[model samples]
Target: MTPISSKGRTRGGLAALICGALAAGGLAAAGTTALTPQAAHASSHREAPLISGTPQYDNTDLYAFVSPDRPDTTTIVADWIPFEEPAGGPNFYPFAEDAQYDLHIDNNGDAHGELLFRYTFKTHVRNKHTFLYNTGPVDSLDDPDLNVTQTYDIELIRLKNQHVMSKTKIADDVPVAPSNVGKASMPDYGKLRDQAVHQLPNGAVTFAGQADDPFFLDLRVFDLLYGGNLSEVGNDTLKGYNVNSIALQVPTHLLTESAHQPVVGIWSTTQRRTAHGSYAQVSRLGNPLVNEVVNPQKDKDTFNASSPWQDARFLKNVTNPELPRLIESIYKIKAPAEPRNDLVDVFLKGVPGLNQPPHVTPAEELRLNTSVKPSMHPKRLGVLDGDTAGFPNGRRLTDDVVDAALQVVEGELVGSKNDLGDAVDANDKEFGHTFPYLAEPTEGSRGPLAKGTSGGTDVRSQLGDALQPAGESRNTTLIAASAASGAAGVLLIGTGLAWWRRRVRRPY
Candidate 1:
């Protein structure tokens, strides 16, 4: 045989070492390998480069679970990045028909076998009218038939053994729905709304349509830190004030593999038409939005490519395994030595933190352990009270994920007795009490404005000032200011009490 190249020999040796370690450490018997420090840091978010601009395909978040609000059923919430403009009207956002959206679950730690739930949409244009309708001067309006009818059907596919074996239509021949507040007849928007609020056979309810985008992140602040390098540190600017959203609610029985203890993972996918008329698609195939990870500048066009599917294949290659190391290297900070392998156990294993894990996953996919009983009318601020249904489970539109994330970063969730040290809450934004649960916009309403006018003034400056951190003093002027800011304080107080007490005590 020809002599093996030095590089090939090295690779072979490394593979043997890995296998030997797994077997010797007894991990092979457990069907799991302890993620090496490097491998633990390799976990990435947002794979497709083009997804940066296309929030519809961004797959910003994946949530799987037995619903806390409705324990008998399971709910899968997939949040896409780059929030859409709610008023990006004319063509409201809808899931791509050809695209395959999936929710995956790896019950074993090997991260190989996954129970996949896929979704596909088929558009149905009821009326071939170009324009939706004309509002002000019907006579003067260029397009009188501005109101058009559109509908789409939704299909769910279950993937096993790398092939789709079963398919179910969540919505059978449903109309393209519109916002609920609009007139019912002119567009008969109610029909669409009604179609969305249908009841499934298992007494489980499913709603899929355009709802108020619930994700609220201070994108402007992030941009300021990395892009503009602004000095306004205590500012809170919600750049994604409005966006298109797709919401779904399913019974828990449907998700669980045998009503025993339900556990699952979820993620979304998007596809687009290639220049060749054929389509290109992306799946769990690659790391999402590499621009956010590697090269922010050169990755823009890469993120905008029409063929995201092609990009998925090379995802694992581009991913830097020592991502946390890279960050620490760049920042010139020491990497924390608090057991990185245990992170999956703490973060993804439903360990209480500033927020609960969205779901339980064998390897960090959005995991929801159905064995955990659902909380009836559970408090939304989960980690504060030790409820596992909140943030880490499936993040709700109203979840204070920023605050939750901050707490985790500060080591607040792991307990004061732990060597990692205790952390305190920094940001404060509670959620509303409904589906698509985001705090109601500070702006009053959405309607026709004066000739030369604008809608809601930026509430960030005001709200940010009122909510800024007060340093070591637990009761600072900022807290008082927030307390005085209308009913916000009451909600905060209630949620805070629940969080403080629940966090202090462990609940099974």
Candidate 2:
């Protein structure tokens, strides 16, 4: 298999036509009920209905790859609900212990293959106190009435030859350790961010807690263009927002089949209590909130019930390499040559481009080429930017996946000289640079900006004027005009120029 390099940009014109086709044909039929082909294969965002209400279990996207921070380990990031608040608590969120989190592999190249590793969370909450407020300014040194403490457990499982084995327990009802549990017994922003990091054995680490959601997009623009109105764009506005996150980093050797064959596929699942009132009934499974495959409100439960168990029949319809011809037949547009072949070949052999005939199986899991070295300077631009860590490998929290999908649809990666015309700003804001991998939330009611001191009414205007685009500095003109001339020469030249211009334009 040829290793795919991440370095190409979408050609403009043809790119636009493909996007037009996708918009007109793919998304035109999208809604709460049915999904179009173009939208089916795109990154999963707002894809399933069950997660619409429960953001934590939504599983909007999943990412897996060799860790750039530590190549010996593999890193997996699971994102839910687009822009969750990083600091929206007194009531912080945690992953459900009963939920079964999985990372699947397909070494055979077939979409349906063997299971690899699975993680289960077992939440153990103790001393559940209702309110956190107290009337007195000072309390007793050993006051049990101060607050309630929380904790949880996590189990890891590995599967081989269809047999399951419990690998290890990362954490047990270990104190739901507060960010600043010891320092002054009150919430401290700095300590909270720092305490979120959890170190594991053998150089592995895990951080699970509430953090700012890192996705930002002007959803209103797309909704207005396609959905006819932006009335439903509630807290979806992207000026500045965040989400709760759970991040894990583990040694790569533990996940790969062997160092010689480093490629692996990945996916995530969540189970909840169905109305049947049986805990044995794992009513929900599959990565929710993604797929962007429209589902009717009536079929929401159907979508959930069918996602994890029915992949061979339901998912293969769109994920199958043979489906593009079906797409062409349905949309009545000529399918581009290279991408049609690329999809078929890659789906079959795990090759990067359609450069080689497929030799792998057709599993519908995210595939990663472990032989490809982890990028020290990772780019969030996804496939279009030539980064393997983006889509087709595994999904990352910060990837600009919409652009990547548009590029693929327009055949940009296949050396096609056509542009996709889906040019949107590429430098949108992203998450931070460390564990939990999200930025800290700014405090106070003002949000991104705080109120001014001294009743300065013009602060907003002054701030706006200073925030200009790159290269045009405020003192550029003054420095350019005065640098070459001596101090007296500058003054004399300025006066002379002013007088000459005034004389020539007087009454003219």
Candidate 3:
């Protein structure tokens, strides 16, 4: 077991205090600005054209933070399969068996991974003929009634300048928590989730399964940037949806280069098996909104498949971001002057003196100083709010990255610090405080379901009978007809909405 010690606060605290001082003054001034760009923000969710069609392989978000409860370790959580509907039955979400989900670590400043954790999944079905996801209540991971189950293997690979130096299968046959298939099927999803949290022989903790999508932001930004007048602000579009997550908590010593070098850069990637039976990297995510806000349409998919070492190609995108120009066009705000080195420091390279590595390569990564202790009371605005323990240092679930990124993109670091946001401040569900700290997945039975549906209630009705028979009272028949018409109208609206969503490139 690693020794418990509070480390790096002297440097981290002083740096945070200085950032805090600047944020305090700038935030207060920014408060009075009339232009709040709520529509100009979103995280990585179906951000690219190709990934939108393949939710199973799309890497939605990646979070890395020093364990708040157990500071001796760092926990990294990578989520996939964005926007899972709770009631989607028959076949709920599962980690793709033909894909490789990876978490990459760059301990030195070489812009390439020195360590890589690869996860591969395999699904099992108890009954081949059965269409049901579960035959009966799944009280445990090994329940015989659970027809469809998933297990995964994790491999730890040591790399030297992207060359594999060693490969070891750290854990295998670990149960993945099943989807929350309503109360009737999974009576205690929480218990099942706990059971999936396996403690490995190497003092690492691993969990893989469905959890509430922790990234929060007004995705309505795509709706004409919040209806152009900010009418679509303040609502968390991702509320109630779920995502398949793979989490790992390892000893702090394992991630650092040495005691003298405490900084580490992390990112996640997904490689899908191609038709030739070879895997091709399809999706990559590190810092939030990089592909969505920083990269343009032509290069969106390109960035996803690229390695950090080759990030110099995308450097111009950061220095001259389209987000600020778009903001300038819609609102009257002046875009930050070009060759924006401020953004280069904050996004491409980690902020100097805070999370930046010594002699670092300019590349994208969720850089974290593992020695920085978790904040007792973490601020949502993250480093901008002076809470260096949060985002940009490495994202905690509670960090309000949408607001933080908006302000930073709008020149918060270059002295123009104002709170420009999507108006959605926090996650709709509260996150847990344990090893796998995401909120419980929203159950299919977690109600306000269809109008008359209730637990075990029969919803079957005679087709068109509710419209009233010809012999019924004239007034009653007329009223029934009116009700049926209203129902039909609602159905049409819903159908049209679905079609419209499909038409958009980044619907989720």
What TM-score does each of the candidates earn?
A: 0.57, 0.62, 0.82
Candidate 1 residue 15 Cα shift, in angstroms, is 34
Question: In candidate 3, which residue ranges exceed 4 Å CA deviation?
Answer: 1-43, 449-508
RMSD of 3: 11.5
What is residue 247's positional error in candidate 1, in angstroms?
2.9
Give stretches of model 1 more than 4 Å off: 1-48, 53-56, 105-117, 124-130, 133-146, 179-195, 224-240, 272-280, 283-335, 346-362, 374-381, 410-508
For residues 1-508, could you state the per-residue lDDT of candidate 2 as single tens digits?
A: 0112234553333234334434454322221112212111112344455456665555555656566656676677665444544344444454555455444544434333254344444443334555442212213312353353334455666554445644667665533323222223443545555555667777777755444444443354244322333233223344344443456777777666666666765555555544574432122322222244323344444544443223333323333333224335543434556324333223222334311113443333466766667556556554445555554455555665444443354355344433322233332445555555555543323332234444333332333224445675534432344443335554455556556857887986
Each candidate: what lDDT? 0.40, 0.44, 0.79
Model 3 earns a TM-score of 0.82
Across 450-491, the per-residue lDDT of candidate 1 in tens digits comes to 122553323432253345465644334335444554456544
TM-score for candidate 1, please give it.
0.57
Ranking by lDDT: 3, 2, 1
What CA RMSD would you report for each candidate?
18.8, 15.2, 11.5
Locate the minimum summed-lDDT window of 10 residues in model 2.
Answer: 31-40
Give the per-residue lDDT of model 3 (tens digit) for 1-508: 0111122312233234335534555322221221211111124688889888999999899999999999999999999998999988879899999999999999986678999999999999999898999998888999999999999999999999778999999998999999999888887889999999999866889999999999988887777666776677888989989999999999989989997889999989999999999999888998998888788788887877778877766766766788888777876568878766666667655766778777677677888989889999987877776678988889999988887777777776665645578877789999999989999999987764443554333232212324546786634443344355555554445455556656885756
lDDT for 397 in candidate 3 is 93
Better of 1 and 2 by lDDT: 2
